[model samples]
Target chain A: MTNAQGADKPLVLVVDDYQDAREMYAEYLEFSGFRVAQAQNGAEALEKAFALLPDVILMDLSLPIIDGWEATRRLKSDERTRAIPVVALTGHAMAGQATGDQQVSCDAFVIKPCLPDALVAEVRRVLAARKASAAR
Target chain B: MPSTAPLTPPAAPGSEARTESEPLSADRERALLWRLVDAVTDPCFFTGLEGRLLIANASARQLFVADEASNAGRRRAVELNQRLLDTALASLATGGASAVRRRDLSLVDPVEGTDLLFELVSTPVQEPGCTPGVVCVLRNMTDLGRATRALGESYRRLRASEQQARSERLRLDLILDSVADPILLTDPAGGTVLMNDPAERLFAAPHDSGEATRRRARTNDAHLSSFLSHLLSPGNARRWRGELPLVEPGTGAPMPMEAVASKVLSDQGETISIVTLLHDRTEALEKARLLEQLRAASNKLEAKVHAATAELAEQNEKLRRQAFQLEQASAAKSQFLANMSHEFRTPLNAILGYTNMLLQGVSGEMTPQQRRNLQRIDSNGRHLLQVINEILDITRIEAGRMPLNAADFELPELLQEVMAEMDPIVARTKLAVHTALAPQLPPVHGDRQKVKQIVLNLLSNALKFTHEGSVQVSADSAPATSTVSISVKDTGIGIAAEHLEKIFEDFQQVDSSPTRAYGGTGLGLSICRRLATMMGGSVAVQSTPGQGSTFTLHLPRRMRQA
Candidate 1:
């Protein structure tokens, strides 16, 4: 997606292996007043996150190469993108355990097939929590 | 015939050697008789009836004369002559009127060491004018008498030995007769010398076929001869055992028999005879046949058992392989379903996401018809996603891959949470929702999220089926039972009694109509029961037709670990 709105809107980089799920989530995030960018895999996600320096990351866990957890680890380790919040999105029913057990260090874990409203509300909640922590 | 010279009186030498005092009488006939008597081999002498010594023959001179060739001979003869004459005259003094006389006498002479025995024969004769005279002849019997004693002793011994032999034969006959087996004694030429009663019965059995053929074979004696003659040859072994079939008396059946032939040998090592004993073998042969048959049957049974065991092992191995293959195939199917379940959500997310946007008015002003259609699409998409989730859950449980995130939580609080989650459905249907949970419900250890899922499904099902009547959510726990029961009662159209159990199966409903009218994949109750069971709990239902059903989720206070 192209960033057509003001820079004040929190930018969310939506990464997923499925182009449609990625586009759908990005459209809803954009409609929710956040600027949305997209990548089809974790490797593309890493490149875009570095270039865009987005305020938040919506990551789909089951990606082709460099899965969401590895990309999140890379983003957290890199000084340039270490501050970005990575919210995990995946269709795995048991990924809830990954978030609870701190397997991925994601800001929040959202099972896929959730409503657009729920997905959008999660992104805003993660962005606000990241901002609140950063301010502290 | 040996002779001594003339004997004389003891004073003959002193008398000038004239023997005229004892001359044969003046009768000529008497003299002639004396000369004949002198020529005899035996000793002859004559004595007168008047008791006088008249004359003696040449052999008689042995008693009275020594021929005067040696001094000791002459002296010994002289001494014995006088005594012999005197003794003789005394013996002739008896009364015999001169017929003829014989006597036996013994004498010990003064000149000899041993007694001499003699037989004296005398004849009295009257010769013309002389008085009657007697002439005597003497024979020495020493050798003849000794030989007679020896003959008599030998004859006595012969009689004793013959008596002993007869008794021994009698004893042997009794022994052989008393035995039960047939016994026969045969000569060296195979002739029957002796036979006992049993043998007599054996051989004397009327001439049957065996005897005829056997007797014809021998070209000699008939039934009385030995049947073991083949072994009874003169030089065959002393003891021989063999089978020789003899006929039973009168019946004439070929009886199985064993005959032992023994040879009797002489001290010179000659085969004197053969003794054969026969034994009947009817019972022994019958027993042997039975034993052979039993052995055959035993071998057959063992073979059958071995074959059956081998077959069972083969079948067991085949079944084991089939079971292993089935397990492998089932594992592959579960793996496939899990992968597909994960893949399905990506598209399901798009369906639900886009539909949420259209119904949310993010895709601007739509017609009323279009809005209504979008709501249906959104609901169906949600239903499809629920079905997928249920299938994925069941498959995971079946594969034993579902992990429980168990924790301790208040059962009443869990019930309130499930009520809140089903509020949206209860609102749309205008169904009265109520909760009747015990205030002092105990805490439970379980997977909270799956419990929520099951509780939500139960509440959802209650709201979906009940159109207007109240749906009650009630929970109660019994500390004694260590269980907690959560029941969702709905006043909807109930299930028939027969369909109560059927409804809980995977992808089953009371009927096809309810599945279509209420819109469900029919997997909800199955997934609920499986999840409950996974946490060591269960789901049960009670219902009657036209009166709504109450489905209860019974959970343990503590989850049981594998």
Candidate 2:
């Protein structure tokens, strides 16, 4: 799995509308030995998802122009992006009800304003599950 | 014999003169006396001793005659003459005057049917050398009686006219007294002649002046006095007007009076009196004051209402600005959470992914402990990712930013998927998971994904809360009302009644326990309710403190899509 660059750090995509939050998440992810890129909205997230094909996507539910719900649907629907595991990052606790069979196109759901340990834990679990499936 | 002159005929024959008497025979003397008596214009006669009319003058003859006939009879004259001669002879013998007066002597003419009024004057002529003769004069006095009667009637009529004039004056006085308006009269010479009781009282006078020479003046009778002064001024004989405020002596309330005066002219073109009419303006004054007060009050009320409206407008503007700010803040918070999650997950993904690849010996085989250490890293990384997902979900739900995708789908199939998803967890915990869908239940038309998410969340909550108990999922149809209800119940640590309502609020749980035991964002129920409401539905929980808890999702058969 190591690339030509020795000790290849995992790359992450941060999608949010606020600059402060993007910088904050970038700081945390970088310190954790990962390469990070930021998208302010869902449309940017979609664009970067294709160009970078990052290890995982951190999707924000509320975004300008195209929200996370539609962006997730498009990502899961496309053949190229469908295999990439998508997880929802939302501040609103109200997303639980909206995560129905037809609505939750992503692999998993998460809440925002979370503890750092919880945040790191969820990101690790979904990635591990993806690697296991790929090895199989 | 101052001059020896002969007096033959008089200068005028009607003016005759007589000498001293000449002696003659008795018959001649009596004839002469009768002729002299006939010269009288009154009725005269001579009667015999036995009451025969021996002689009579032309007036006496005419008196005895009936109509134009002369010498018609002597019987009636003889009776009248006998009474007159007897009265005259008796008066001469008794030494009374030689003339006797007899009135009311009734004499009937021989031919005339009625009697005539007569005055008989009898005189005895006992002259020397003349026979003893009786003279009787009779005159008609009916004309005199009528003249006296006419004079007496005129006197009585004059008295009655004076009485009528006095009574009319008294009646006029009584009428003026009974009236309320003051009334007064002045003479042509500008003297006060009459005044009524009201005039006296109005002027504060003790007595009303009668229509006479004497009159008492009142202190406040200035209007009348001024009117009379103006009329007698000889220059301005026209009408005059004056106004004054009259104060009530008892109550001290001032009354406004308007007085108008006009000259009363006589037929001779002389001004006699001036009548001044007074009108009270108290009611008119009071009405004007009340109108002013009402206008002032209306203006104040209108001003107050305008101020209140202005204040309300300002408050409404402030509330609108506040609402806009809150909306912006919420949107930014949601964006921040989403961005953080995306950025965090990517790097974490690489770590967990590389660890798994190393454990599988993708490039080289690893030792047992190394593999175990890599597995730990992978598992911990996965747990971190799970927490990240829960945090993002809760943030979206709290900010009311959760997305709901609505579409038509078979509700039973979706429920089966939910059971399939929860089966592994239930099997690991060794808890029974049971489900039932109402027969012939209408397919719910709502956010299909959101509905599934709600069912899954409710199922996970049930499984997590329970230790080794049954978790049941059931659906019921109320087709009559076009709605479906899904319920998930678990025999777990129950919620209290009070906490039941608060448990659906964002970031709130029945108890502040860590998520490791009953792993959730504490926002699951809140998000479920919000999403349900977005699809025109609602979520409610029924629980007992010790028994168990049941979460129900009631949704419409058809709803407005997001």
Candidate 3:
């Protein structure tokens, strides 16, 4: 989490294999008035999500361990992290496929080479969709 | 008298006659008879009632010759002749006067020493007052005995032959009946001369009224012809082979038969009768039927094998095509890996993001010089991103994989969006931007995103090349050609005539000097031209060095797929 972040602020977990890309996104989200935690792989991401109880997860599909899709699935299946939204951020097109007609683990898709601002916007949109669905 | 003499019977009128005229006729008759008897082949003799010799023929003398050593034989012969007379007299005493006495006699010739046989005939004479005692003769009979023996031998042979012929006939009948198939011997008129047991059963008449009802078979016209007429025909061969059907006795289904008919001919070559042999063909027909069914089943199995082989061939072809597609996909995968890695857009994204954060004072406060340097880094990173994007775009287009999103869009509206997108560059540089869109420019059918990218390329080129003059964006429709042209006019350093064509090639610029004022990868014009060509359009340029340039893109009103 960023220093000086308030308890009222929402938490976001950023997962990526690329360290610089993960840190940059975290830095921008921290600046954008959200507490941001980081993980370099999907295994670390799951650990961070469960410990921090983050409001949302930014997942990169290709990872060194436990892959984003499987990590997201495990997170969704657990009661502790079921409510948290997952946004897939990747350079590759359509890396995560939904199993038949099931609701996908990733709540949003953002093509990479994405600017920090666009990534923030997509994260906000996924969070907002979750909020609306929860309100219903 | 000689051997030919016929002196008459001892009881003849020569003994009974009393008239003198009778004696002359009788004597003359006696002489003629004696001459006839002398000409006979048999030994004839006549004896008087007194047992004296009346007459004798040559055969009698040869039978009882009186040669030098035969006087006793003559006396014995005389005694036998007189005894024959006495026997006739004795038979007359008991059997009345008309009866004759006869006996067989055997004697050996005294002269020839050969045996002889004679028949002795003795008769009583009664002509009122004729000669007394009896009249007799010894008739030579040796040749008669020889003839009788020959006749008896002939009768014995005839009887044996008849008995053998009867047995042969019976054997022939048994052989004909023993045969399984019906064998019939018939006359030319269809009259049955001989019918074996099987033939009799085959051609039996209908059961009589007192018997159980049953079918009795008769030959049809063709069968009759095959059995008789065919063999009877003079022009036909002596043998005939043909097929005929006789209805079964009870089932009435035809029992097929193979017939062989042969004509029995006489020595003169006339048809005597016909012999027909009828063979049952039921077993042969059943075998043939089974063989036919087996062949049909085998043929069906062969066809099934051929069909399975064809299906296997089709499956192999499908697998081959799948392998080829997999190879192509692998090539595409490698291409993507090389291009995406080389581009490194994520790093550029991070750099620009960090630089913007610093400029926004998120990292801390920065000096004006530091801000300026940071801005340069940001700009350079952005430029590199554009260069990478352009290279990737060209690569995709050359691979013929660039996807199009063709839709109707107003050219003036798209131009407004392009101008707005370039406002930052316009402000950064001191370039003036203006649009002179035709009042009634029609909406175009094209890939809206690609068309916008082409417009952006032209606008950015105009803005980048020009030093201080205004950049003009204009669009107009050519109604006759069904086209719309968007021209980007710039007051900038223009291309030479030789370099004009070269500028449209990939990574080509008017000037290659390192210190040139304008900076770019020089791929914008090439990309624009290719995009225009892909959309059924063209890009034309008119320029003069150090004065101005106008690059116009001509697009069709409707998209035409290549």
Index of the highest-DockQ prediction: 1
For B113-150, candidate 3 gives per-residue lDDT tens digits of: 46566676766555777555455556777779778878
Model 1 chain B: worst 10 consecutive residues (lDDT sum): B1-10
Task: List DockQ, one per candidate, in order.
Answer: 0.58, 0.07, 0.21
* Regions of model 1 farther than 4 Å from truth: A2-4, A65-84, A92-102, A105-108, A128-136, B1-205, B208-296, B512-518
Write down the TM-score of every candidate.
0.66, 0.57, 0.48
TM-score of 2: 0.57
Rank by TM-score (best first): 1, 2, 3
lDDT of 3 at B114: 60
Per-residue lDDT over A1-136 for candidate 3, one digit per residue giving the tens place of the 0 to 100 score: 4454588888889998888888888988988888888898889988888988888999987788788877888998999998898888766432223454233666787766777877888888888888899899
Chain B structural similarity as TM-score, candidate 2: 0.63
Comparison by DockQ, 2 against 3, better one: 3
Strongest candidate by TM-score: 1
Better of 1 and 3 by TM-score: 1
Model 3 stretches with alpha carbons more than 4 Å out:
A1-7, A46-53, A69-84, A92-107, A129-136, B1-343, B428-430, B513-517
Residue pairs with backbone overlap in model 3: B3-B38, B3-B57, B3-B58, B4-B37, B4-B38, B5-B34, B5-B38, B6-B33, B6-B34
Which 10-residue window of candidate 3 chain B scores lowest in summed lDDT? Answer: B1-10
